[model samples]
Target: MKYGSTSAPIQLARGQAMSSVKPWRPDEPAATIHAEGAWLQGAFISKIFYGIIIVLSWQCLSLLWRQTTRSNYKTKMSFLAIVFAIFSFSTLHSGYDMKAIQLGFVENRNFPGGPSAYATLSRSDTPGNIACILMQWLCDALLIWRFVMIYRGCVAPMWLLAATPITVYLGSIVIGILFTIKKLTSGSGVRRT
Candidate 1:
């Protein structure tokens, strides 16, 4: 054989290399879990994770305002009180504990199957699921109190008075319930598809 000539072995090796380095094929089918139509599993937690910091910052500012303004102490304190209460609840509900639950580091005993069984199959866990559920319930109660106060304080538009707090409380309740149910039924194990 002529040493410099193109030969079958070189051609076969080149063919093998090309096949081994084949590009990804878009036509390949993909599989994913429906996850019971839950939206909060991924997107929701990420949003809330970032939002906790902002809520805590607001709480800090409200506290500082109350401390610095002596002449308007009553007004500042009142505003700060409301802000602090809300922020405290928000922080507790949105804090890292919730994230840990979501991430599945802390097992959710509330799940239907035994913790080990569920854990064996789950992919992700939201850490603060418990805190969020409790917080939403608390928010509902607070909204009722606020609604009553607003009604007694002034003759505001009926629509505005009815809509704002009701929407917030109800929305939170719905979200919390949905997340709780999802967590309970989804099993205890973590698996990635």
Candidate 2:
């Protein structure tokens, strides 16, 4: 067998030879296969983490539901609503991700740029992305609300103290909206040709 020089040693400007530093070649089939394997591994890991989160969220939901009664009903109901919203969005996001993964790896495995590239590059999962954005906003707003409630009277010039989170919250909303609009109008986030 002839061992051709498919990968020759590269000489650097610093009088050094790099014979082992392989450059990334996305067009290569081997590289695409490697990327697909890496993406699948990451997806599996995410599923595991999502499973853990589901268990924790279920536990929290049950505890909160058990605590709700006629007394303090209003406050408990508000907390329950926030928690339920978070859970719903998280579930929706996970479901979307799973669907995208299946479509990219199974249904469209021969898509133009390969399955990994198609899965990673496509912004077709806009619903999932938006759900993630909304979930984050909800969590952040909840935190800000808690902060304000705890320090409403303890801090003088409460407005100044609370301004940071409020401003940040609003800024995030604007950014998230802009991002969603851009994604929606950008046409499929991948190239077919």
Best by TM-score: 2
TM-score of each: 0.39, 0.75
The parts of candidate 2 lying over 4 Å away from their true place are: 1-31, 120-123, 188-193
lDDT of 1 at 26: 26
Q: Can you write out model 2's per-residue Cα lDDT over 128-169, one digit (the tens) per residue?
A: 989989998999999999999999888478898899999999
Question: lDDT of all the models against the reference?
Answer: 0.57, 0.80
Root-mean-square deviation of candidate 1: 11.2
- The CA-based lDDT of model 2 is what? 0.80
Q: Model 1: residues >4 Å from true position, as ranges?
A: 1-49, 52-127, 153-193
Candidate 2: the clashing residue pairs are none
Q: Output the number of the lDDT-best candidate.
A: 2
Q: Report how far off residue 156 is in candidate 2 (Å).
A: 3.1
* Cα lDDT tens digits for candidate 1, 1-118: 6877778767777777768564433222232123312333654675665487566757666577847666887866765665565556556655554444444423454444333334
Against the true structure, candidate 1 has what lDDT? Answer: 0.57
